[model samples]
Target: MEIEFFDILSKNGPVSWSPNTVKTRLCLNYLAIPHKTTYLSYPDIAKNHKSLGIPPNPKGLEFTCPAIAVKQSSKVFALQESLAIAKFLDETNSSNSDRKIFPNPGALSLALLVQRVVDRILNSPVAKIAIPKVVDILDPSGREYFIRTRTEWFGMPIDDWAGDLEIAWKNLARDVDIFSKMLVEAANGPEGGPFFMGSVPSYADFVFVGYIVWLKEANEADGESNG
Candidate 1:
């Protein structure tokens, strides 16, 4: 049976904004897993997950995007959180041994490091640039929910949180330089390639690719060239 991939979608608009969701999607594609996406609008995310019997996030959030439900034999498994889902898929899908997501013991640690750096550091400025555009494209209800939640989370209005794009852009450039330097140092080792893990794409590559995909979506929304 095919897995059910739950993704956050904008009502009457595109559904590729969430970087976490994109990470799981990239993992699924790289593993050649046969799955189908079930898109949910922002306001409905928590309710939909509850209806499917999925557990709430341990971090106390009501729900998160990028969940997956898989039915194997007589058992059904549902999971939330992008990294957990990706790790699960990589370990469980034994058929694709050659294209393993983790690759090795050290690879998992490296991948987690990259994921953390991107999520905790690089995403701040990117969110400043993208979240406003994302909110503008959502449906009325979704927009309201997003604004309220984000305002609370950021302790300010989303619009004001990203004040001064010039500074944000400069910060983003510095973050990108740091990331590029790390990649270059990694490549300096014996193993090197266009991807994160030598010649083959790994979970690390998917983590970075997710950010790239989000940037692409944001650029398209703003009528800017991603190049």
Candidate 2:
């Protein structure tokens, strides 16, 4: 069955600026799943999810995007949370072993570890900078919704969050540098340049890619070179 995937819409359309949503999109792409994406704005996410019997995030927000609904013989399973959804997709579509996201038994734990560390070191700082810039590409209500909600989320206004853009980038670079050294030493790169596990792709690598995409979007929005 084709999965009904939900993604938050930007002003530009179906391409979401949210890293979590983009992460799931990449997961779906990697797995080559048959899924149709439905893009919604910020205000519409909760309504759409709730209408589909999707539960609110336990400890995070009231609702989250990047949800998927799959219909089986007798049930329609609606799942949220990118990592959980990724696990489900991998488990269900892993008949072709080589196409699996988790290459080995330890890959799951490593993915989780990378997910946590990257969220802190990379996502946190990047959000401070990239998140506000996303408003430029959102609809009017979405713009307001993002500002208000994210302000509360960050405990500061959007401008204040990235008040010193220089510091925001500096923090990202410093923490990412530290994490890079640690990650490299812990898991040495292979002959094909660099990745979390060398040449092989993993969910952990997608986590990094998601953040990179978000940063790139922000960079483009700011009319600044990534350099």
Candidate 3:
């Protein structure tokens, strides 16, 4: 149970700010793992992670948060990426093995499939709406890093990311309609409702909810900023 959860900090605090970190938080909640969360600014992620001896990511950014340092007996190992971390938590479920994320072997595939679909279809439109407001939620350090990276990533400034609110909202609604139809098709039985897998929530639910939580929060921040 000796674990340290690293997450990005925003002005709104550390509970459920960043979508990626929120996914980790959801997985941790699902596992009921006791861990202390350590907040870091955007610039601090690379600095602190390298100092911590956490290896760079194989694919994208070398260092990122929503990471965990798990200690067993004498050795400490670090893990990053929300889905990979979820798999780890599932494997290490010593307490409630029956109540699990991967109820069957095929569930892992399902979760991965759902995650891919979420990343492809929903991430951009939602992120387009969320990123600008997210900048308002960060302190100077995090804000600066967020703006620079996002500007390069999006090929435009933060303000321009959500420049046309009317158009952005319309586009978002269209994407959401497509996504909702997906959920409807999956809702086959009485067990189905909010979750992708009916009443039984899974990692896929957490993955989809992570983006949505941030979107909702970002819109809240947008309103607060306007007022």
Candidate 4:
């Protein structure tokens, strides 16, 4: 078999708290894909994103830390956005063909629902907590923009910062409850596995794993900052 190669862009030693980045790494690990990580500083990422074809965000064109580059036919395809990258890699590799990482016709509906729930937490409440951390590291002056963007996107009251934090926590708790129930259901299945699809780790597994790490870190930081 020809050796498969991938270039994963990451911060904090290839696998830290960035779920999207970690998702890519975990999926690669699961697939046994040989890869190398290119650790880029903030300045390097900013300078290269446009050439890399990554769209700019408040985080800048670096695409929020965990961008991936896939090598095929001597050309590299750089992908930003976690789910898009995950689905693309899953489909590209044959080892994942039978596994169905992104779900299929039968499970597609449930997968989408799970995806939405995951996205809400990651982009909403989780983002509420994390944007500050990112801004602290990447753009201290842009903190207001981060707050305003999250508030507007999540449709939360602009003045109610404490209220927004509470809402985020409540929303996250509901999601965790739903996930716990699903995990229980999955674990009891005929095949028996800790993944959503019972025997195989699907897209939900990667998505859930990413968020759990983020939520935990955020919670820990909240505790330390207060204490």
State which candidate has the highest TM-score.
1
Q: Given candidate 3, what's the lDDT at residue 138?
A: 85
lDDT of 2 by residue, 138-171 (tens): 8889889988988887798888777778888888
Cα lDDT computed for each candidate against the true fold: 0.81, 0.81, 0.80, 0.60
RMSD of 3: 2.4
Q: What's the lDDT of the predicted structure labeled candidate 4?
A: 0.60
lDDT by residue for model 1 (3-91), tens: 99998776545465678899898888888888888888788988878877898887868689899989989887888998899889988
Candidate 1 clashes between residue pairs 3 or more apart in a chain or in different chains: none
Question: Stretches of candidate 1 above 4 Å error?
Answer: 11-15
* Backbone collisions counted per model: 0, 1, 1, 1
TM-score of each: 0.91, 0.90, 0.90, 0.67
Of candidates 3 and 2, the better by TM-score: 3
After superposition, the stretches of candidate 4 with alpha carbons farther than 4 Å from their true spots are 1-13, 41-46, 53-65, 94-109, 121-123, 134-171, 221-227
RMSD of each: 2.0, 2.3, 2.4, 5.4
Residue 222 in model 4: lDDT: 37
